[model samples]
Target: MTVELCAQKAAAAGATYFGVEYYGECYWGNSINSASTQQNANLCTSYCAGNNRQACGGLTGQLGLYVNPSNVVPKEVGSYKTWVTQGCYSDSADARSLPNTYNVPSGTATTVEICLDAAAGFKYAAVEYGKECYYGNYLSPSASKQDSGCNMQCAGSPSELCGGGNRINLYQNNAYSQPASEKPSVGSFSSIGCYSDSGSARALTAGSSTSDSMTVEQCVKLAGSHKYAAVEYAK
Candidate 1:
């Protein structure tokens, strides 16, 4: 593509910078950081696919970077319907405050809207480490509220706050409706008792599988298919 076309696309997406690489590949970003360095103009010898007279980039390590003249500022996260801040909470790799989902499908630069959309079905949604999005029906028992520490800027919208290193800026969707718990049974297998589990050391490590809509019967059937004597389910 031509430089103008790439710039237009980046500007339309509210990007502050755009770069052309490997002839027709276009990349967009909100900021130009240390990872991007200036190179000699002569190194960019590859002709643009749309306009042969204009050089796009080089086949080697070179990029034709340009700033978007439009300078359209990205929309920041604000008050969402039926959603209110639940305050900052403690989180950890081993024991997360919201442990259901780690991040959204597109796990790049994260914003409050992105996290809330990913967690639409859940009661709580949290953003952490500037870019991480998490969802859960209930907060972990180990998690506790913190007075301060949720101060990191959002990766997608710098005007919004995402969370701190090990803290999560939690939000609750008041409109959420909790689904009924499933009571599944498989053949003759039944749950023996409640047991504790550790992420660092799994109780059953031979083979494992996970499903978003997993039930006890599904887990038991899967284990039976694999000739496993025991089945463990994690919610």
Candidate 2:
């Protein structure tokens, strides 16, 4: 079977570790960051497009998916390592958010969490998978190719798989291996968040309703509903 098909199969089988293909050589994603892989993916895309092909093969380049044997986690923890196919991070008094498939839950629990430790003045964090990126402070994304040796790739849509809950900001050196429920102090008020709290808290509590007084989870839950305008976390 082709490497792409193999990748799909491996993903279905719940593999965590995988290798990337580029220019007849293999690159380990877990050991490398997405940037390198992204460059390789770009090379492949260009090579394939030039060859008028849709997939990789029979060409000098055109990255093929690599298959590895590792368990996939609901979310990443401690690191946004190259091997990690996907994840989220952020920096703020607010709790970072992952997609419903990662940490930020949706209609159902389809994801996991990797709550990082809180620190002082952390300014940046990154969430990546393959070549896709979901990083803190990542506002607008532009499509581009990555360096070689890695098989990552990005299509340039921040919201495609990187944004939710009013945009989270991942901090540096933060590490949490537990679920998001464990941290009730992330004081973020997401525009698109999980707000299913007090049956009465749905609507504006009063003329001057705000999230500054609410806990992290409470603010998130409030953000999820249509009643509240938006949570305003204090600076």
Candidate 3:
């Protein structure tokens, strides 16, 4: 009751950001003011009465201001979600023509994050043979074998699994989208057919070679320069 009331009050007061503090008090602000001044997540410890799972805000003086995505583009902190597995399948034969495919160098280590980063635009992503990553719109039902088939450690992150021989560590991209009907099988990122090698695609030559180090803004800029519809991450 108190949290909602405070949010309402903040909204009425024309605050772009609002925070609930010490469980009862509410603070409204026009802007964050300074990026460096923002407190770390640990500082905000007060839980909301309405939902215990959610944090209401910080203590006194330190307000927990929630920034709307509509108002701000959250920085693309390097993160990846490990999704459910799919059966072993071939990109060229079993799986339909993959929209984009990038072969990670044999000696160079590759993580699921790196592969997914390279496959920026497609909906579905799969890592196979530990060193190869493929991106496409959807997975064909006929191509699926069994989840047990995909059991290999990621080349880069050993703690994480990639896929086994001829098998694929398939993932549905939550961020990528398509038509409602056609979207069911397909999933995630960038342009449809834009192609580039790791060094050339996102202009990762010289300094920026690792896909993990690339930011969203940098990817967008590189894609824009090529006049391509979009720039998918991996080579």
In terms of lDDT, the best-performing candidate is: 1
State TM-scores per candidate: 0.47, 0.26, 0.37
Return whichever of 1 and 3 wins on lDDT. 1
Give residue 59's lDDT in candidate 1 (0 to 100). Answer: 86
Ten contiguous residues with the weakest lDDT in model 2: 109-118
Question: If ranked by TM-score, best first, what sequence of candidates would result?
Answer: 1, 3, 2
List ranges where model 3 is wrong by over 4 Å: 1-99, 105-107, 179-235
- On TM-score, the candidate that comes out on top is 1
lDDT of 3 at 163: 70
Per-residue lDDT of model 3, residues 58-162, tens digit only: 665555655332433222112466333343554444444345678775434666777777777667777776667878786665555554655565644444566
Candidate 3 local Cα displacement, residue 99, angstroms: 4.8
**Per-residue C-alpha lDDT of model 2 across residues 146-233, encoded as one tens digit per residue:** 3222212212211123322332323343332333343423444324554554555643554433443665455556446444443433
By lDDT rank, best first, the candidates go: 1, 3, 2
- The RMSD (Cα, Å) of candidate 3 is 20.0
